[model samples]
Target: MTYTSLMFALFCLVLLLVYYVVPKKFQWIVLLIGSVAFYLCSGVKYILYVVITAFTTYITAMLAHKNKREFSEKLPQLKETLSADELHAAVKKNERKSRAFMLCAVAVDLGILIVLKYLDFVLSNINTFLPEGSALPLFSFVLPLGLSFYTFSAVGYVVDVNRGKYEPERNFAKFFLYLTYFPQIIQGPIPRFEQLAPQLFGEHKAEYKNLRNGYQLVLWGLFKKMVIADSVAAIVGAMLKNTSVLSGLELWLGMFVWGIQLYADFSGGIDVSRGVSQMFGITLDINFKRPYFALNLTDYWNRWHISLGNWLKDYFFYPVAFSKGYAKINKYTKKKFGKFFAKTVPVGILSLILFTIIGIWHGANWGEVLFGVFNGVVILISTLCEPLFVKIRKRLHMEERVFFRIFRSVRTFLIITIARVISLPSNIAIAGSMLLTMFGIRSSGTSFFAFTGQMVQAGDLKMYLPALFGCILLFVVSFLEEKGNSVRDMINAKPMFVRVAIASVGTVIIILFGAYGIGYVASNFIYSNY
Candidate 1:
């Protein structure tokens, strides 16, 4: 169930009550049941997908572990007498089983993901070269929510188990809770087994602190999502749907608003997820910081979707850069081109490939593919030119000045906006046209005043004002949050009565003014589609 929904909120409250009342040892069972109930509420069919994935990985890891033990037992006689070379062979044999297990897990998870998420796109492409009458019929498939997220987590767990980084979970129910935790089922910061497994199996008694802090976080996230994102979404949706009729200023405004909407929508989801988990005395990973305040693309990524970026770095970039072929190329470049160029070239190539994968991971569409390539190019160019830029700054003696820093920040934001525009477009052609229009090389009669008038005529002005105000409020709050001030801590530091009053008012505001179950219940977060 979606964390933002009333159904989920009520469900969590009931689960929380039952959890604390149950015996300490049975807490995991309570959680397992709750998770199952949560997924079943989504529909029984979706639960099958979750169960199939959980059991498949569980069985594979068990077999892999068994194989390793058997091999170790067989080599016990030689362990005390064998030479280093013989021991190496035995180790290699054991590693092969682990590798095979990981391969199977990856194959199954990716196979399901592709069939469920991209089969239609594939069939449509195939039909392009065939006769009109021979076109393939499209069939509908209901993708299980958070399949992309949980699949990655499941694969990461099995790979970690194979690598001996974490032991395979022996209890089926505990493992199931890890995969289908209600808070993270809809969207995720993609928890690792090492991070989440202990909590799943631990005895978690409810705390007053957890309740207060968790509710505060949930309320704050609601403010961002309903007050800020929903309002901006109204404008962004209108502009995008009628982009052909928009002018340059109107288009840019819409793009800017879209950027805000995306940040609020995605980060709001993270906050709500974290808060819900917190209520259960579980701490999930922090997924966002004040990314817009970042001084460069690299900084932006570090603050935004911190989990996914780290995963890509660890799983994709590191392997590519450290591969034998990559090392050989690096050594060759160092010998032929000199040390300075060699040091940077390999990493740049690896970064490009990783970012491209990042783009494709978002979707199978050409727009996403191009978006990934666009980000990769931006990051690579920034990396390559960084030293040059630093050198120029040093020569000008502007490195330490506030003005230079501000200038650098502005440049970074613009680059990020351009990259995100490419990422968010419906198709490659529209993205290309937008880029052309952005560069002012194409003449388009899209005017800001005209679009503003159109928006007012369409009854968007009333909602737009509060959303704009909310955006400003969010920025101020985020600025404080970035400075390391905790909003919850600030509220708690006040008198108890004050805290209660603030929370009560926040709840009332959310109920009266929140976007859901009113004019915008049909709208979902942008990333939910991914």
Candidate 2:
């Protein structure tokens, strides 16, 4: 069920009631049932895919754990009996086998995701090269819910287990709950096995603080989605509808709004997930960190999609960057062209790979591919030219400028926004045209004011008022956060009646100004595609 629906509200309410009422020991079972029920509600068809990943990973991890345990048990004996060189060789052999096992399990899990998400995408590209009469029919299935999320999570867990970071969960049912945790299934902070497992299995006594914080978070998230994101979606949709007639200024403005709508929708959803999780005494990772306030692309990435970025850094980037192959390449470069290329080339290459994967992870579309490629290219260029930039910055004394932070943040936004052509539009040609129109290409007689009038709905003001006000409020909250003040903490520090009054107002505002109703559903939440 969708989060905004009446049915989901009732479902959450019912589950919460049962969760706390059950005995402490049985509380986990209640969560398991609730989680399974939630998954089944999403779609029974998805169950098989999840089971395949879960079971395959489960078996692989159990076997790997066993092998590692045995190796640990034999280590002392091996050290005593074998020479140092022989012991080192034996250790390397064991590591090779463990790596192989990890790769095999990861491949199986990734294969499922590829088949369901990208098989048709691959076929479509191939069809273009063939004659029309010989075109292949598509053979892909519908993607399971949170397929990207869970697959990465499963792979991360497998890798960690192979590295002996943590032991695998022995109980399959409980393991399944970890994967299918209802709150995170839609979009996730992508829980790591270690951080989340204890919380999941441990019994938690309900606390007033948990309820208070959760209530505030959920309320704020709902308001972001319903009041700001959905409201702006209408305007952005209208602008997109008449791209042929819209001016360059208008298209760019629309892109700006798209960024806002995207942030609100994505971060809003994560807030709900984290908030709901808090109520259960399970804390998910933070996904966003005032991304727009970031000074540059690298800093921007660190703030946005914090979980996925960290996952890639830990699992993908480190492995590839530090691999023997790249190390050799770096050594050769250092010998040939000195240390700069040796250091920066590998980083540039890895950034391209990571961001491209990120792009493809978003969707199996040309736009997404371009989105990844565009970001990668920018990163590559920026990395290569960082020394030059540093020189220029010093010459201009830019760091000392009062508006330096504003300038850098705005520059970062503009770079990312220009990439939105292929990102949100998905069609390469259309995206190119939009980019053209966004810069200087425009039709005559389509004034920006007229377009704004249309979006604002004939001077009614009600159409844009809530979104404008909501965004102002959102910016204030985000600004405070960027300044190291937690708005939640601020509210919590207030007197009891004051906190209650604030909560009451937040709830009432969401109920009154929110665009959601009995049948309301969101379609433009970008991350949901991933």
Candidate 3:
């Protein structure tokens, strides 16, 4: 089911052929069957999890809507004669029901996630506290592919229904399709119900424009993942494995390369997903937008992982900011420390907490928690200092200078690189050690050239040259894309023969030079695990 796999490519080709041949009305049926088949190939046992989640949330959302309707009906009856106590009691009862329903939805989603993803981690910690003779039962469970993604979408759907942002989906099949859409199932830009469901349920006639645009996007994504990210990974893997033997300069270089590798690998997957969805006449949200070009920590967040960042801001940050506790704190700070302090400090503190939760949401490890906190701290510091920095720049008469802007951009990139190191490790101890080693405090001046020489001797150097060329190409293409020149538009502007020639050449290059088949194992998209 992985986008980069041969099997998936074959499956897509077959599906496309069948889809265009079928009547438009029956096309959805074909897609649904294909989705189920895809899930079955992933392993059948996990289908139960998907069914359980979809059904449970679907029913719960309906019930929640019914309850809200019932409460609203009684509100007018009690409006005039009801005392303050009676009104309070009635409101409290309704609130309790709403809270209970929400809790059930959250628990079901989180419980499945915990059992499938973190049960082993939890049990291992508990086993340490038991005696040696203890015979605690241990079992292994295969995590459902895309469980983290679909579950969140499902949960968000139910929550939105309860909040009145969306009406409950009355049709079970439509709801299921929303949760298990094949293209976005494995990795996602995590579609929202309001944004995506309409497209799925509405009329979708295949368009030549969608096909041309989508195919180009898929090719761009392949170039990034197969040609660029994978090659960088080989180099990074060698350096990280022998960190003890690497020079300080080598370590820093590896970290920088790793940042690029991760971005290409992840954003590449997103591009393919978006393209595939587009081919099906659905438009998924954009995920990344030149994050490295950001001029500040705040700007970096806005560009990087755009979907997840916005999701967190909407579902977590906003609620906490407007919560009673936060409101009280804001009021207190305003009265005591002034409006400027209140406006910034409350948001920074709340953002720190939300980011910490975001980190833990990524995994069941302390490393991820630390990573989240590291990012939070950087953003928080930047928020507090931004005003002062702006004042200083204005005072120095450097506010609008190009050089100052370039310096800020470089500074932001470096800060992001350091912050991402903490995010990549498996444990806080390793992350901290890596940071220390990166600073040259643990340096022994050992030669890293010898290791690089060995890599070259082993014929790994050949794999990297194409990737370097690919990276340069990717940069140029991205620059063009930033300027609003889409691949499809570029192609369409050319003569018909020219378009065909370019596509034929691109296909030949991919078949000959792309990393796949024997001797190469295509790695799964990293974000899929989340």
Candidate 4:
């Protein structure tokens, strides 16, 4: 069930009531049932997919944990009975067995994801090179909801066990709960087993403060999604669908609006997820960190999707950058060129590779691949020119000024907005054409105001004022957050009458301004596709 729907709101309210009334010890069981029921609502067949992932990770991690325990018990016996070389060989053999188990688990988990998500994309591409009569038939497999997210979580869990990061869970139900937590399973911060497991299993009696804060955040998230994101989506949809009839100014406006739509939709979803979990007294990791305030592309990435950034750094970047192959390259470059070159080249290569993987993870399309590569290229170019930038800044003594920092942030935002086009359209060619039209180099001769007038006649004129008000609300909240102020806490600190007044006004705004109801078509959260 989508978080934005009225049905989902009623579901949460009922679940919260039952959750609190249950005996304290059975709260976790209540969650397990609720989670499974939630998935079943999507489709009975979909539950099978998540079960496969959860079961595979559970069995493999237990096996690895058992092997490690056995090996440790036998090590002392082997040391007493054998020479140093024999002991070393015995240990190596056991390590090989453990590694094989870990690899098999990872392959099965990721293999399922690959076949369901990318197999069709792969087959369609292969057919392009084949004779018409010899083309392969495409398979129509329905991808399970949040397949990428839960698969990655499971794979990371088993791998971490192999690396001796944490002991595996002995209880199967608890372990499965870690993988299937409903709020995060839909779109995630992709919690590590160690971080999320305890919270899932422990009892949490509903507290008044927790309830108040949780509902507050959920309402705030609704404001961002329904009032701002869905409202702007109408204009963005109209402009993008009729780019051939829009002026250069209108095209640029559409692009800017799309960026806002995407941010509101994705981050707003996360806020709702976190708020729901918070009601149960479980605190999920923070995913966004005031990304718009970042002064560089790297800084923006660090803030934008904090969980994914940390995931890549831990799983992909550090391993590839520090691998033996890169180690050799590092030494050779340092000896032949200079320290600066040695330090930058290896990291730059791995950073590019990481972005490519990130892009492909979004979808099985060439546009996403190019989108990833484009981001990598920009990041690498900036890194390579840092010396020149530093030299210019030093000469002008402009680096430390407040105005200069603001300019840097604006520059980075524009660069990211341009890069957003790759994934905005169905194909790369359309995105490229849109960019050309946006620059006034290739207009279709339609007046900008005429297209906007069409929007009015189509009953979308009512959305504009609400969109503007919502955007201003977003800016104010984001600015306060950027300055290290907690807007939620500030609200909570007000007088009782004031708090009620604020909540009443916010709810009224959403009821009147929201874009979903009987006549309006409710849209799925955008990141739900990923």
Candidate 5:
């Protein structure tokens, strides 16, 4: 269900009442039942897909864990009987078997994701080069909800077990709950098995602080999604639909608005998930960190989708960077060029690969692939030119002034906003043409604000003004947050009456300004599809 829907609100309310009312030990059971029920509501057929993924990974991890236990037990015996070299070989063989088990788990889960989500894209690409009318037909596979997210999480779990980082969970039920935790089963911060499973199974008493902070986060998320994001969605949708007829100024405006809409929708959904989990006295990782305020492309990445970046770094980038092949390349570069070039060049190239994979992780389309490549290329160039940039800064004798920081932040924001076009459109060519159109060409020499005025007129001032106000409020909150101030903490520290007054005002704002109800359809979070 969409997070903004009334059904979802009611569902959370019921879950909360039952959760705290039940015996503390039974809290986990309630969560499991609720998660299964929620997944069932999406589609019975699709539920099987996630179940199979969870089941396969769990069994494989258990087998790997069993082997690890056996090896540990036998190692002492082997030390007494075998020579040092022989013992080493035997241990290596055992480790190889463990890796094979991990690979099996990865293959099954990733294989399912590829077939369901990317088989059509692969077929179409092959069809482009085929003889006329001789192309293979594509499969009409229905993608399971959050297939990539859960698959990656499950794979990470099994890999961790193989690496002996953590033992495979012995209780099947708890493991299933970790895989299918309802709040994160849609878009995710992609929790690690060890980090999240214990919380899911642990017992906790109902706490006032948890409830208060949880609801506050939920309300704040609603304001962002409903008031700020949804308000801009209308204009963005219109501009995209009629790109051919849109003025250059309108096209640029759409891109800017889309950047806002996407951030709000994705981050807002994450906030709701965190809020709900917090009510149960669980905390998820923070996903966004005022990404628009980033001073460079690297900093932007570090802030935006923080969890995903961490996942890719740990699981993908680091592995490739330290792999034998990359090591060889590093040595060659160091010998041929110098130390500085070798140190950064291999990392830059590997980072590019990591980003391309990230892009493909987004969708089955070529546009998404290009989007990933674009980001990878930009980041790679920045890394390669770091020395030159450092020299330039030294020559200019630049100070770390607030105005300079703002300029850097604005520059980074615009770069990301433009890069976002590839992911926003169905076709890459159309997005490219729109970008070109936005540069200088305008229909009938219309001013930029004139097109903006037309959007305001179409939306009516009542709708338009609130959206503008919401953006302003969003900026203020983000600014405070970037400065490490917690508005929630500030509110919580107030007197009971003052806290109630603040809560009441927040409720009133949402009731009056939220873009939902009879005339509006709830939009799914943007990242849910991924």
Candidate 6:
């Protein structure tokens, strides 16, 4: 069921009731049952995919950890009986066994994800070059829900276990719970087993504060998804359809609105996920941190999609950047291109590669590829020019200025909006041409105010009004939070009547202005597909 659906509400209520009523030690079992129930609701046949992932990762991690343990127990004996070289070889042999397990698990998980999610794209591209009637038939495998999120998490766990970050979980049931925890299965913060497992298996009581904060957070997320994102989704769709007739400003405007919808919808879903988990006394990672307030691509990425970015940095980026192969490339760059490129270019190149993976990870499309490349290049150039930008800002005394800070934020947002166009539409070429067309365009001779009026007139203002107003409220709340004010805490500090009144009002507004009441269409959260 959808997060905002009545059925989901009842499901959660029933689970929560049983969750608190059950024995302290058995609470996790209750939660696992709930998770399985949620999984079954999506589709029963897809259960095999999860089973395979859990089995492979669990078996691999257990075996890898077992190898290490066995080696550890034999270490003293080897040291006493063997020569230095022989001892080194013995240790290396054990290490190889563990490494093999880690790689095999990673390959299996990634293989499943690649085949289910991207194999069709590969086959389609291949078919384009084949003899007309001899093209490979597409398998069209359905991706299990949360395949990308869970695979990353599972692989991360296996890699960590192999690296001795923590002991591999011995209990299959507990490890399975970590993977299928219902709240994050849809759109995850990609929990670490070391961090989330104990909390998952730990006993939880029905604390009043958790119940209050959680329910409030859920309501807030619904407000964003329903009132803001869903309301504006229609406008984004209409603008995409009419892009051929639209002026450059109109297309740019649509992209700007899309940036809002993207943030609201994705972050809104994360909020709900974290909120639900919070009620269980489990804290999911904070996935967003006022991303719009970021000053550059680096800062923007650091704030936006914090979980995945951190995951990539920890499990992907650093590993490649710190690899022996990269070290050799660095040495060669230092010799040929001087120290500056050695210091910066390698990282710039690495960042580009990392971000391109991120872009490709979003979807298996040429548009997404271009989107990643565009972002990667921007980051590369931005890194190379950072010193120049600093000099310019310092010379002009602009770095510390309030207006300049606003300018940078706005500039970064425009760049992000431009990148959105490359992927947000069905036709990437048209989108590319649309951006290029902006440079040489004759103005429509319409004032900005007139253009905005046209935007409102393009769709039902009733739909537009809520979205626009909600964005304003969102900005205000975010601004306050950025300034270190907790809006929820502020409300909680008020009298009981005040808190209830606020929650009631927020819930009623969501119901009335949400997709249910408005002409706006309710769709799945955008990131759920990924």
Q: Is candidate 3 or candidate 6 better by TM-score?
A: 6
Clash pairs, candidate 5, are none
Model 2: lDDT of residue 512 = 70
For each of the candidates, the C-alpha root-mean-square deviation to the true structure, in angstroms, is: 2.2, 2.1, 2.6, 1.9, 1.8, 2.0
Give the per-residue lDDT digits (tens) of candidate 4, residues 1-530. 79888888888888888889999888888888888887788889987888888888888888888898899998889889999999889888888888788888888999999999899999999999999899999997888878888898898899899889999988888777788788887778788888888888888988988888877888888888988899878777776677676776777777788878888888888888988989988888988887777889888888876787788788778877778988999999999989998888778878898889888887899888887888888898899999999999999999889899999988887777777777778878888877787666666676533354433343377787888898898999999988889999999899999988998888888778888655866578888845
Global fold similarity of model 1 (TM-score): 0.94
User: Model 6: per-residue lDDT, tens digit, 222-278?
Assistant: 889988888887678777776655666676777788899999998999888888888
Which of the two, 2 or 3, has more lDDT?
2
* Residue 222, model 5, lDDT: 84
Candidate 3 Cα errors over 4 Å, as ranges? 73-92, 125-140, 397-399, 445-459, 483-488
Per-residue lDDT for 526 in model 2? 55
Between 3 and 5, whose TM-score is larger? 5
In order, candidate lDDTs are 0.79, 0.83, 0.79, 0.83, 0.85, 0.87
lDDT of 1: 0.79
Give the candidate number with the greatest lDDT.
Answer: 6
Better candidate by lDDT, 2 or 5: 5
Task: Summing lDDT over every window of 10 consecutive residues in candidate 3, give the lowest-scoring window.
Answer: 448-457
- Give the poorly placed runs of model 1, Cα more than 4 Å off: 72-76, 81-83, 136-139, 446-452, 455-459, 516-522
Count residue pairs with overlapping backbones in model 2. Answer: 0
Estimate candidate 3's alpha-carbon lDDT, on a 0 to 1 scale.
Answer: 0.79
In model 4, the number of clashes is: 0
Clash counts for all predictions:
3, 0, 0, 0, 0, 0
lDDT of 2 by residue, 1-530 (tens): 76666677788788888888888888778888988888888689778999999998988988888877888899999999999999999989888877778888899999998988998999999999999799999986777788888888999999999988998899999899889888888888888999988998899888888877887888888888878887788777776666667777777778898899989988998998888888888888999999888888888899988899999889989998879998888899899989998888877888899999888888888888888889899889989999999999999889878698799999999998987767776467777777766666544256543454454452224647888999999999999988899999999999999999998998877777777545556443456636
Winner on TM-score (4 vs 6): 6
**Candidate 1 lDDT tens digits, 107-148:** 888788888888988888899989979999876678887788
Candidate 6 residue 401 C-alpha distance from true site, Å: 0.7
The regions of model 6 sitting more than 4 angstroms off are 440-459, 518-522
Q: Which consecutive 10 residues in model 6 have the weakest lDDT in total?
A: 442-451
